[model samples]
Target: MTAMIKAHEIQGVIALENSFNRVGLDHVVLVKVATAGVVTRLMGGSREEVINALSNAWIDGQSLRTYRHAPNTGSRKSWAAGDATSRGVRLALIALKGEMGYPSALTARTWGFYDVLFRGNEFKFQRPYGSYVMENILFKISFPAEFHAQTAVECALQLHPRVKDRLEQIEKIEITTQESAIRIIDKKGPLYNPADRDHCIQYMTAIGLIFGELTAAHYEDSVAADPRIDVLRDKMTCIENPQYSRDYLDPSKRSISNAIQIFFKDGTSTERVEVEYPIGHRRRRKEGIPLLVKKFETNLARRFPAKQQKAVLDVFLDNRKLVGIPVNEFVDMFVI
Candidate 1:
């Protein structure tokens, strides 16, 4: 767990200033690099072996960000991180088997990663990594929407009871959000599938406003077939609030803020509902952790019998016991 957290921090801190998207590369490249470096160390590889594994990861072809954007968005965006991590392990194993690595994989003038993938710019870091990323990780507790749209969905849910029965009377729904949400999730056209819908702020807000809740199932075609969702989506517009955008990038704040207001044709409007921090934000950890534990237990019940659930929960619920258990032993407990 500690090794994994370090890996996450390495990837996240590098990503803070490195705009891979601007160069058409996916952020999962960091996942592969970080994972290969740390997993090699965890496997008891020597310093040279770790360096070799990291070089292999850098030279491994990266996935294009195209699959995560409009016109090509699909399930590949969902599985890309897993694929990167798997490749990371493969590279680490190859290094352990004595494979030689290019010492200048990242800086080899003509054919290196910096020139070929990053537009000739070297990687940048905001800070030397430690546990910052793990300590400040955001969780998607109540909604399955994109992280940038999480607060947007919360705002919509807050206004749901007032607007659910007045769908026809609503003239427009204005969504005020951070620039990141606009850049990544503000969609104006037809969404082809669940992947597209989940990434669209308008579609996610529509679901929350109409149903008073947003869930993974809500993104399915069966529920999406409901014409009312599109009706609300068609009446929606998203605008960026500069302050929200600034706060989103502020390391001290790291907020994903959003506000929603519904205007009725008759001139009355729902009070603007704003959510600065999501339920799963670190700022709300006191209120969020219990819900997170409940969610975990509920998920466990879906896959395990009652006795098995209790057995697993016994160790998991006890922090000392959970952390003290050997990795292999802990993994074996879930094998059944």
Candidate 2:
């Protein structure tokens, strides 16, 4: 668990900057790099072997951001991280088997990753690897929407009761959000699939306002076929709040803030609803953990028998007991 946490820290810290995204590369490349480094170390690889595995990861081709953006968004964005992590493990094992690696895979002048993919700019870091990322990780406790749109969904849900019965009376909806949300999820036009819908702030907020809930199923075609969703979506105008954007990148705050207001055709408006820190934020950990545990139990109930659920929960719900169990033994608890 510590090793995995460290891996997450490595990836998350590097991802604090817009490094990979600025280069049009998907951040899952960090998953490959971080996983290779940590998993190689876990398998007892020597320093040289770890270095070789890391080099292999860097040399591995990265996925483009296209699959995560409009016009090409699809389920590939969902599985890209899994694919990258699998490749990471494969490279680590190969390196352990004595496969050679390029020493300059990232800096080999003309053909290196930096030159070829990053526009010749070196990767930047906000801080050294540590527990910061793990300590401050955000959970998607309430909605299956994109992280950038999490607070937006929350804001919409807050206003749901006021606007649910007056959908047609809404003349316009204004979404005030951070720059990151604007850059990534302020999508317009038709959303082709669940993947696209989940990434769109307007679509997510619409579902929250109309249904007073946002779930993974809300993004499906059946629910999306409702014309009111598009009606709300079309009425939405996303505007970036500079302060919100600044606070988002501020390490001290790291807020994902959003506000939503509805204007009625009769010239009246609902009070603007704003959410600064989402339920998943570290600041809201006290409120988030119980919900997270409930989500876990609900998911477990879907596949496991009562006895199996209890057995799994017995270990996971107790921190000391969970920590004492060997990784393989812990994994075996879930094996059928």
Candidate 3:
């Protein structure tokens, strides 16, 4: 979903619409990891990839900086498939060895990836880390959605209980998202479709308010028309939480939390509520971790009400889980 939504966002960027490039470097981050994968994989298992990996990474990187916040549009954003292994293919074609066509194709755009994509200005990398290849920790955890708004959705889930009753009375919804998020995810205008709908923090939060939750189903065109959703989105106003912004960037303390509060027409308000890190974040490892066993258990339980969830769980728990397990045996577990 991140890829699909990101592609849409890329379309917006190409169209020269609102650029997330200025404040939030979300675009370059994804593009680099995507195009540079093969080169990075080849450089070393433990050691970082060679400097030449920069070539592709640079193109992907500078593109983010080139048009951020400048309204734009294009079809690139709609590509459902991710990168096409540009690094390996490029290497295979050139077979060049000594100096690179350039170092850091992504993060550096000038005499680099930029000359290829953005025209000229040097692309700026947000931070230095091996994490760029895999993507930031926060980006990895999001099954599908922007990293900045993860906590925003998390906050909405928690606030649903309190505000569901007073949803109609909500004169306004005030949100505190990372300042970067305010600059990036905030949007207005016709939502062309679900891909567009999911990225709109206002729309995502409103779904959490009216439905008291969001699931894949909530984004469908049929469901998006719910009267309360548009009402809440239009009534909403969001501001950046400076500290939240700081915490969000701390690599060791990464978070995607959002704080939400609802105001009533009569001038009353509910408790201000917040979610710091989403359940999916790395910090929640000890508590929110979902073991393979639990996934197997829950899945089996759903498929066979009369069958045993414990039996399914035990198989996953076995220490030698996959070793020596025949392909047929592995496939059998999934069948009812």
Candidate 4:
């Protein structure tokens, strides 16, 4: 535990993100699981948590949603972190109860988390649990954008002021992102929806640069159709993260840092800027948690009442109270 960065910590994140990227898992789901798992451990969990969580959790069985489609991503992200915490909790509980895990979990499914998500691989231990995950979770600080695209968004934000007067002067917008950007966000042609548009590195970077602001609405069809977006995506390029990948997977490090550069028709290009972790990461916890809480508050208020929201927030703020609260109660609060 001293040497290893808990899968949920920033260090763990660094390792998992790079390794999973090889197989196609985004840092988001892994981050969720890592946070939830490590947190669960903090709450004194065991293996039963993982199994029971796995049992109740559904695998969509749809090829479009399966790992084989991308060999890296899937829908499990929605609940996987919760699943992970539950798994951790279950494992802890199982150990407490003196029950045994199905030995097959380590080898059974055509491949476990390894074979299924990892390309017939095994977990390579670079270290053990520590404050690493919290220390390195990338912060979505500048833009509430995805981790991989945040730097690109930041670059666009900078260009927004300069390009505002030259929207027409820009013959083409050129930008570069890490290789993960190309695989996960780079796109061409008409982006039909916000989901599609936001994922397009070109669309995301261009809009941020042009508008100086990016929100969930920025990715919508109306915004995506703004002609300028496609013009920019047309100029975008993304490449693999050799060092980022190296540092990303090094058990002692975890980051979603990305570099972004822009060019104008006149041939002058802005300096490339790189950012490693999202503001929401643990390293920035001292500064970012309050902001994350704000985000959580904003999001919670959107779907829940003030009183209910208060209760939920209060519980989350209190570690002892939160861990003791029934899972059903937590589920009930989230359910409409």
Candidate 5:
């Protein structure tokens, strides 16, 4: 059902045609629009009501780009999607009560989403709303790092065994990645908070090399206080790979690639290791899904007794049982 919902969105009328970040808007605006349409229908609204709710979502959506990166990055990046979706539900509920929607919410000359937020550019679509995005959405199953830097972290982890014993002897660490990563996660200087640290490519790579793994715990102040992370970060350099950038934005390929190479003070260098795709890519679903399930079970086990955990895990593990259960009923099973 989640995949079904996402498919409906990515293939729907209003789709991600233009780059929201390039226009200074947060892409989560799409989430608000998409969620409004789905939630309105779920609440038994007619097609007209759903349209009204969706229009309102567009009219009300803010760019929220500041919360996504740099000096202003904070816990809000973690909650922005929830915020957008929640706002969508509220808008949909209001529209159900007869709140009107702007007929020209997207094209009203000076006051429309296109003119105001998109600089007069119309929304575009590559394909119809469908299950494709759901089938192909990237997941950060192997590391807690940002999706853009997932492969970089993997690349760094590969180089860890060689560099772990010679940290002080390393003179430089070069990381080459797609341009989107450089635009989104490349960071230097002091990171102010956990959100800031987790999103930094340099920070993620350094931690992966130093600790051999990156978990949520590694983003904490306690772990970050290890001076070696910043020391390594200072020695690291990040640049864009044109081929990677092209493949990342290509409609068909959509690969996220990163290569890490470390140079030692004694003029020795580690082999340059490149990871073209993170484990969670659709291309590697067979390899990724099991690990993703294990990750889910591990997190679930930390909260519940073994018997209860297995019971819950069993419900999820069985697709037939899981899909047949109502949403409310499934959620009730996790109630403390």
Candidate 6:
């Protein structure tokens, strides 16, 4: 799909000015819209059919707010984007079979998506579609936590060595993050499962500080049963730092900064540690890419023999060999 359009098209969607989540909608609707247009065109649909397919994508998108946020964050948050993409492909397939589309699906009177879903405001764009999103994509490199809280986990890891020996002596812990982190992951109270724990900033920080590292297993029930985690969560306070919030959305400096400080029961405190951009941020690409490659190598090594792993890694490590390969052929390399 990316190969079919100019990078600007992807950039345009990334730069969308409106917050769909703010209005009780999942941003994955963009995925559906993009997929529908691309799939329809790939299926040799007429221009009108492509438009119709996109309109249907909008009309069918679920707000999906509860699955990700609110009092019941769950596993569905991980599946929602895939569901949207599947629906888009299905809609495109249906459109290819001569199905009629609602010409005014988005603009129709009171029943339109604008009036019904968007509270009467039409969709708005921040820039023309481009590949900026592809180029600056946030990689959830080491931690399995939410993207906004990744830096917080790094901060916790940095503070882990000093705080490990004084867990019970700690009085309170302070976490400062951008507004988006507060909005998406500043969770409190009981977290029921891995899905919930992974999204909770306090849980991630607490576990990182105590364990000296965090992994998928840390969010599991067995690991979460450690009473020390809940103890730390109870003593933690999270707040929005306006500067971090401002810098987070800055186009030139898309930093996901987080700060952590701890006060002991005694009259002592750890030096306030702050990390501006996570290792996954584009700004850290030089340092991050090697780690990403190592991560890929590690995962591949776990699944395949060294010989097979080397064969697979060779294809991915070489840009010249990978550039013009057919998509099907590339995927077939991993068929085993």
Find the candidate with the highest TM-score and give its number: 2
Name the weakest run of 10 consecutive residues (lDDT summed) in model 5.
7-16
Worst 10 residues of 3 by lDDT: 131-140
lDDT tens digits, residues 1-336, model 5?
A: 864566255433354356888877887888788788788888899889988997898899485689778889899888888888789889989989998887899999999989998989998777776666766777779998889899999998888899899999999999999998998988989998899999899999999999999999999999999999999999989989999999887767779999999999999899999998899998888999999999898888888888878879888989899999988988877876
**What ranking emerges by TM-score with the best candidate at the front?**
2, 1, 5, 6, 4, 3
Clashes of 3: 26
- Any idea what lDDT model 2 has? 0.91
TM-score of 2: 0.98
- Model 4: residues >4 Å from true position, as ranges? 1-120, 129-131, 138-144, 171-176, 239-241, 251-253, 307-336
List the global CA lDDT of all models.
0.91, 0.91, 0.58, 0.59, 0.86, 0.84
TM-score of each: 0.97, 0.98, 0.66, 0.66, 0.95, 0.94
| Prediction RMSDs, each to the true structure | 1.2, 1.0, 7.8, 6.1, 1.9, 2.0
Q: Which digits, one per residue and each the tens of the lDDT, describe model 4 over residues 1-336?
A: 331355545435346434555554543444434443344455555556544333222121211223222333333544655554454454444444544344454345774454566566656654455564555556565565656677667667766777777765565554544555666666666655555555566777788877888887886667766877666667666666677766654555555566766666787766676667556665567878788778888888999888999989998899898778877797887876
Candidates 1 and 6, the one with greater TM-score: 1
In model 1, what lDDT does residue 42 have? 95
TM-score of 4: 0.66
Q: lDDT score, residue 82, model 2?
A: 97
Give the distance in Å from residue 304's predicted Cα in candidate 5 to where it truly belongs: 2.5
Q: Which wins on lDDT, candidate 2 or candidate 3?
A: 2
- What's the candidate order when arranged by decreasing lDDT? 2, 1, 5, 6, 4, 3
Query: In candidate 1, where is summed lDDT lowest over 10 consecutive residues?
Result: 65-74
Clashes of 5: 6
* Per-residue lDDT over 1-336 for candidate 3, one digit per residue giving the tens place of the 0 to 100 score: 233344333332232222335533445344444434444444332223334443434443333332223244222344412433453335423323333444455345344544544445443444433333233233223224556777777778778888888887878888988877787669776565666676678888888777767776887878987877888888888898888878866655666668888889899888888888876666675554454335445557678654555554565567576455666776776666
